[model samples]
Target: MGFDPYLAYYHSIDYGRASLASDLNPNEGVYLRREALKRYFVEYEGMLNREFIRQETEENTTFQKCFRLQTERLASCIQNTIPYIPFELGI
Candidate 1:
């Protein structure tokens, strides 16, 4: 294996599901136990575990709702922001 500190960190945290985000060499596993372990562990362990699926789903839904609301608010703010205007002043 190569000597990449980030890869070590990724393995330590077991970013199996979102491996592409962390793993420097993300690839499909055709005949490796490591692939099997990643599939198993992600489905049965850590934040993405079945036990927390409901919670994770709810959080993502809420995040999307809140994000949409915030973007709408930002759009309103932008629309109401002052517009530039040129005016001549007497010297």
Candidate 2:
């Protein structure tokens, strides 16, 4: 990764912090799991499996696949010195 983990776009700057991860995180919250890590992983899997319709193509895509596309877009934006367009899960 060419990015500095501490240099964030959305999160506030802090010493020795992984702000870039925060910026990319879709689920931004604290999950104090009573079911250990199992529930966390299960829920995350479910979220990734969830589907959404593409506005331009009118095709369905999983969030996991969308995440890959978004990552590629972000990398392209960085290399080309262009603005990063975030993924939108429309309501």
Candidate 3:
């Protein structure tokens, strides 16, 4: 959390650019109809709550939990100079 959003490892630093935020942005543009949007949200919510075995913790975890875990992991990596492992969604 003490990270400088503009400072990035793979991306070049530039004026008014948030490289970290840009790196986390969705790669695809989302465009959906009303019904499709509803369906998408339903699936998205389901995915957020979906449980899976986390390799690091060896316990079932949801997307929301993984996000929190990854955030903490990143913070630890930054503070302690440990390697940060990115989260992977198998689905």
Candidate 4:
């Protein structure tokens, strides 16, 4: 919505989402950024899932909180990497 940091243009597509463009440096790596986000989110999900399996297991609240913050920042980095120009598809 606002200027995103790891900038990629987002829009609705029949595919469920649309990606229009990006401003990532060749070395900055959108691929790496995407992988990192996926890894962090998966880790968070695993932590919560483990809690369900073992009631009093590590109580991963602290790591989850920290990971949540990291994901937000990483998401921002991905969002702001380019200009998000949107246009209507059926115009």
Ten residues in a row with the worst lDDT in model 2? 24-33
The global Cα lDDT (0 to 1) of model 3 is 0.83
Task: Report the alpha-carbon TM-score of model 4 versus the true structure.
Answer: 0.24
Ranked candidates, highest lDDT first: 3, 2, 4, 1
Per-model tally of clashing residue pairs = 0, 0, 0, 14
All models: lDDT?
0.43, 0.81, 0.83, 0.46
Q: Please give the TM-score that candidate 2 achieves against the real structure.
A: 0.63
Task: Please provide TM-scores, in order, for all candidate models, with all chains considered together.
Answer: 0.24, 0.63, 0.60, 0.24
Candidate 2 displacement at residue 89 in angstroms: 2.1
Kindly report which residue stretches of model 3 are placed more than 4 angstroms away from their true locations once superposed.
Answer: 1-21, 26-28, 88-91
| TM-score-sorted candidate list, best first | 2, 3, 1, 4
lDDT of 3 by residue, 48-68 (tens): 999989876788889888888
lDDT of 1 by residue, 58-91 (tens): 4333333443455565455556874423221213
Native-to-model Cα distance after best TM-score fit, residue 3 in candidate 2, in Å: 5.7
- Model 3, 82: alpha-carbon shift in Å? 2.0
Q: Which is better, 1 or 2, measured by lDDT?
A: 2
Clashes of 1: 0
The model with the greatest lDDT is 3
